[model samples]
Target: MLELGENPDTAYQKIKQLFVHLNLPERLWSLSPTTFSGGEKQRVNIARALSVDYPILLLDEPTSALDETNSKAVIQLLQERQAKGSALIGIFHDEHVKNQLCTRELTFGD
Candidate 1:
């Protein structure tokens, strides 16, 4: 298992492309950590995680930084991964994401 924090290097790209099958490569160096928008950074984070090619993934609030379109794309990506027999544990607050991605729900606190 791989734990990718923020600001991974560009060398992870090749592995990311192979497992996540993404056409877009993140331009991490183009923007400083402070200058990066939430969405862009989230994309980078996902790319870094995908680089490891793990069979199981746990994402905490994966799409929290994304806009609607990117959020949908991320959800679709997770579904595709699941179909490939990869287990994805996604934690989200967005009802849309939860409804679309999850077959069961577990809520903490009331």
Candidate 2:
């Protein structure tokens, strides 16, 4: 992790811990690029992105294919990021997802 406040060592440790917290030990190493389910693959994607430690995270319909439980987990991870002073920009079509996660809404139209 190379973000402003996170040390690489600490970020790596946290990421490892998150994998455990998410109960994804088996999926962590065996996820094939073409064989992952949406939620499982999303977890891996989030892990990779967090490894970068960017101040802002942009997600495009991150939970689109996830079940309720997995979506909640991802939301919790976003909240953690917010607490760390990182900004998250998530693109989602699910009303429940936006309503639960965003403080303000941005709408667009043609």
Candidate 3:
């Protein structure tokens, strides 16, 4: 918190919101993420990446491992990030996800 120049309370609130949005429970916080399921780990990675309010975010298959419900949650989070003027660049195999987060696309010949 001190290193990031963010207030502890404010940081906590941001993380708390991510937890709720990502469906991360308090119990999982104490345990190592190595024990988590694929979807759980994906959410954890999303949480970690969003924890910092960086100007640019590089995402790859952020929603690939998730089901429709969880994928919606992840897309919501990405939309929130994009709304804040973050430069998001990523590879999204899901057409819906790509359409949601990307403003432009480039494709190589198959």
Candidate 4:
């Protein structure tokens, strides 16, 4: 963001959308993550990662711990990122989700 002349603080405000999409209660914002539940922490992890504009992202089972609704939300956010030309490399054990998000597949031991 600095290279693009974008203020990191202002750009980081995107986290609001992330938290909303990931179903994190706004109250989680003021509290320490150590006190959060596993699911909440996982949602935070997803939100934190998506808050930045990295050229390449490496993900491993991003939605593995989420419910169907949350998983769909994550997929929608990822699709939007992909549409904006972000490169996503991930391990998706869920074939349904894999089909939804992946355009090209790199398989091993096939």
lDDT of model 4, residue 89: 96
lDDT of 4 by residue, 1-70 (tens): 3556768777667777789878998888889999998778888988777777788788899888888999
Indicate which candidate wins on TM-score: 3
**TM-score computed on alpha carbons, candidate 1:** 0.68
The CA lDDT at 88 in model 1 is 74
RMSD of 4: 2.6
- Candidate maximizing lDDT: 3
| Deviation of model 3 at 55, angstroms | 1.2
Task: Rank by TM-score, highest first.
Answer: 3, 4, 2, 1
What are the lDDT scores of the predictions, listed in order? 0.68, 0.74, 0.89, 0.85
Model 3: how far residue 48 lies from native, Å: 1.1
Question: Which candidate, 3 or 4, would have the higher lDDT against the true structure?
Answer: 3
- Report each candidate's C-alpha RMSD, comma-separated, in the order given: 5.3, 3.4, 1.5, 2.6
Across 12-45, the per-residue lDDT of candidate 1 in tens digits comes to 5564553244333445455575776677667667
Backbone clashes, each candidate: 0, 0, 0, 0
Q: Clashing pairs in model 2?
A: none
Q: Please write out the lDDT profile of model 2 over residues 2-109, one tens digit for every residue.
A: 555778788768778777655456555655646766667677777777666579988898778777877888778777877888887877789988887777678888
Worst 10 residues of 4 by lDDT: 1-10
What is the model-wide C-alpha lDDT for candidate 3? 0.89
